[model samples]
Target: MTAVKIIKVLGTSAESWEDAANEAVARANDTIDDIRGVEVEDWTAEVENGAVTEYKATVEVAFPVREGNP
Candidate 1:
């Protein structure tokens, strides 16, 4: 049978939430292959001086299970 594996990843950026999410996938790509999709699970931020200094995203990344891996 074929299956997909899902994992969680966190990404942060100073630009925007979208950037943060993209960063998660980009970083995950470094170690994972055949990335099928991603789901944004949560959003958070770091604030300084009454402004958002950083944006953080919790992402669920999906990829096919390797042939020999469980």
Candidate 2:
């Protein structure tokens, strides 16, 4: 049997939601391995002068559980 663990990550982008999600995954991949999937939990955008300035996304990242060395 295999176990999976989930982690929450928040990322910001100046363009779109896709960029935000990609940013989150890129950050998680920096220190983690065997990344399984990503789910967008929430999204928000910042506006300035009646224009969208930034897009933020919260994602749930899942990875396979690793066994500790004995």
Candidate 3:
């Protein structure tokens, strides 16, 4: 049987929410392998002077679990 694992991560962008989500996956790939998918959990923003200064995204990243190895 194939096994999978999920991890949560936060990503930020000065542009848009979509960019934040993509950033999450990109950063995860830097340290993780076999990335399968990503689920956006939540989104938030930082406001400065009544304007959005940054976008934040909470994402759940999935990857295959290595079997018979530690």
lDDT of 1 by residue, 1-70 (tens): 7699999999999999999999999999999999999999999999999999999999999999888655
Candidate 1: which stretches are off by over 4 Å? none
Please list all clashing residue pairs in model 1, or write none if there are none. none
lDDT of 2 at 44: 93
TM-score per candidate, chains pooled: 0.92, 0.92, 0.93
Ordered from best to worst lDDT, the candidate numbers read 1, 3, 2
Per-residue lDDT over 1-70 for candidate 2, one digit per residue giving the tens place of the 0 to 100 score: 8899999999999999889989999999998898999999999999999998999999999999988962
Error of 1 at 3 (Å): 1.1
- The TM-score measured for candidate 2 stands at 0.92
By lDDT, who's the top model here? Answer: 1
Best by TM-score: 3
lDDT of 3 at 58: 99
**Stretches of model 2 off by over 4 angstroms after superposition:** none
